[model samples]
Target: MSLGSHSVMQGDNTLRAWRTGIDTYQEFVVYMRRDCPACRSEGFTTQARVLLSAAGQRSIVATLSVVEAEWLSSGDAGLSESAWAALGAQPGEPITVSHAPPLYSLSHVRAKVYGHKLGDTEFAEVISDVAAGRYSDLHLATFVTACAGDRLDLAETVSLTKAMIAAGDRIDWGRQPVVDKHCVGGLPGNRTTLLVVPIVAACGLTIPKTSSRAITSPAGTADTMEVLAPVDLDIASMRRAVERTGACIVWGGSVRLSPADDVLIRVERPLDLDSEGQLVASVLSKKAAAGSTHVLIDLPVGRTAKVRSEAAATSLGRRLQEVGAAIGLHVSLRLTDGEQPVGRGIGPALEARDVLAVLQGAANAPDDLRQRALCLAGDILEMGGVVPAGSGLTLANQVLADGRAWARFQDICAAQGGMREIPVAPHRQAVDAHASGRIVSVDNRVLARAAKLAGAPTAPAAGIDVHARLGEYVEKGQALFTLHSQAPGELAYAMSYVASRPPIFQISPTGESQ
Candidate 1:
């Protein structure tokens, strides 16, 4: 494996393409027997980087996995789902395996690992390779780690953001003031985007809002919105929905906007590393590529939230504004309370119910959720000049109160495809308090962990519903929260974690836990 060559010595073995039911999160993987002719001829072993070519028209770099099972024979090679889709190979098609070409852009990553700043051209080349799926997960991890913890300066951050935007498809609305909003998420049950999009759109703004699925939380905006209508709209469908209803709520991954961000996100989620520079780049790149002229960023601050303090929030906000301005976007930052989950529900369908309650103006809707959505929507309204500086809240409230936002939401859902009823979990259990006292604190991170353990986002209907609020009085054996799951094993797993940990809800007679 030379580092300076692009030529690959093709192997003599031609194997059948067996589809392995494996999910590698967009990374290509190929499985072959330990004693396969290709492995012996090409000097390939487990974990080797190999180039897979089919029909001389498609080629991809994949990691090698050795299989000892009967599912794959010596003359057969198995492709993971991602690889199979990338190659578009039939089950019995012949494929060639060879040594992968040298990834020259990785040298820049090595320089970054050694504390050297990368130039704009270096970042462009690196991001191009990343977006093209030329890097393995290990390479992605190394690159992400190298850029972690304030390693990238302001200039470098701008370069990276620009590089990321250039690496993906950009949508041009050919219109002014294309508005969008994003929340720096950490707290669970914060599904405000679902409400804010409808409100802003109802005010006659072009708001094609694209959201991501959950990475670490119980639910993401896309995951929750998917419960009511489809969120995986392609660019054309998304445009059509926006044209029909003045707005849309769809998944960002479907549009190829800032594709490098998604590629990096796949690696960042498992590592749990979100550096400041990368965060700014990730947010602004998508906004820029989405044709947004004005953007609102929500920063929720708490001890357990992503932005933990006022100082950190200010710094992040400044960076976001600076990068966004450099990329031709007007960025407005808002710092809000992240003391607890935004609503009573902490999963996909459960959060969708909360959103619907707010939109429909139900008396039982969570006041916190409704008020937060109103505030964000108000700010967005002002940003788009749809309302006066201080009067956006009044207008937003009027729209929601007068049933206009609800009507707009339904129209947008229909335009996106169709609306569906929210689902409910099949199995449920309530966790009760052991001692009676006024509740003082709730750990957002722990509660979110329990919800994920209960199979949220993935299970669609699985999550937790809160019954106790901060400073609320409770009796011994009173219900504090209910866990929803699709399977008994998942419910048991969440319950076991809750049983072993400190009470997620802290209560004291004096209310001093805060």
Candidate 2:
């Protein structure tokens, strides 16, 4: 079949495809010279939607950018890394460039902006367009903003979740009671997934765990898992790893599951807009798409955490359960203390170190992290019917205590790839308490920001090592936390930010250093 028969071929306007070597993540971009013949004739402006078709009948609608540089000849149209891969075009191959057809789904987005409720069909159209890369960044941002806060009702939230699930690949494990776990993130150093997966898998449950990289925090499960082993596993590798070890901890994005949720997240991250409706949809869509029949949700509630008050936690938890029920998932919620970071570390390599310590049952391991992981793992085990309701904790603890969880972790890592050596940052600086007192509070947001400034998930080895916890007494000049960074400048940046702000660790005057 000819490409012209299915797609709109606007005249014979075409240009030679040239690699521009630009990386824009998932957004496809096409570059054309300012004086290019096709640009002048088609009246295509920068950021204009244009369809690029290659010889093999492949096509993609990309946002156009007019290049002022003379690097491209008049006849050549440059392609960004995303566009180049999408079209599968060779060097100097002719690519047909034309104005993209108008998007009809955008009307639904506009309706949402004016406080209108969107139905299943409406959301489906909008998400389908979004997944197909038809909507540009502006359109995506608009869609996200319109649905922000309480703008989306329960029905709309359910519809949106269904739409997101439909837009991406879904896994079917060909069995009953496939289990998984997720955290409603805001707390830092809470890497329970790494511990939970192995415990559950060691107990003989099928857990194909897919995690996301850090969206708003210093390290996500995937980032920390990457520090210990290869986490960017595709679907086939993930399946193989699970088959071998009864579990797999891999990045969800690589498997192309809930793709539209990823796209929405890119916009939501920069905006720092995690609406309840969208948050529910984002977490549950990924869970549902992973073919999970039973799921455990960890909600860490604190004044400085994502879910602050008890009321907020209750509402969000109910919404999660309601949404999961509507989508055929049996959801279990575990609310925990978010008063402080989970463990002693706050970055990829640092958190991985903590995870290793807990799994290996080291005496000095962070007791808080270990307990939280066991609790969440226990919940998953019970939810999967592996253990009777109250007995899950004992079973989970026994697995960890006997070194079974640690051994299974090694097996899973080996299955994914070989276990990797945890990285160390060459530069480090400590932030100290100026006065002696008992630690009263620790701000999660400040610590997270300081970790990011220290070059976190990006640098892998960079992060903070927390020294003080709530109710602990410290002497003047005692270290509160130490910053780790690969570069001196990053170390300095994190230190400066910590200094400029109120003490991250609040200490009430207790007269003497204990």
Q: TM-scores for all candidates?
A: 0.96, 0.95
Pairs in steric clash, model 2? none
Candidate 2 lDDT over residue span 140-194, tens digit each: 9999999998999999999999999999999999998899988898899999999
**Candidate 2 regions with alpha-carbon error over 4 angstroms:** 1-12, 510-514
Every candidate's CA RMSD = 4.2, 4.4
Tens-digit lDDT track of model 1 for 1-514: 1111222223556676778779987889999877778887788888889888899679888999987775677777789999999999887678888899998999999999999999889999999999988898999999999999899999999999999999999999989889999999998998999999989998999998989999888999999999999999999999999899989999998999999999999999899986999999999999999989999999999988888999999999999999888888999988999878888999999999999999998999999999999999999999999987999999999999999999999999999899999999989999998788999888899999999999998999999999888879999899999999999999999999999999999889776874
Model 1 lDDT-worst window of ten: 1-10
Report lDDT (Cα) of residue 260, candidate 2. 95
Q: Which residue ranges in model 1 land beyond 4 Å of their true spot?
A: 1-13, 68-70
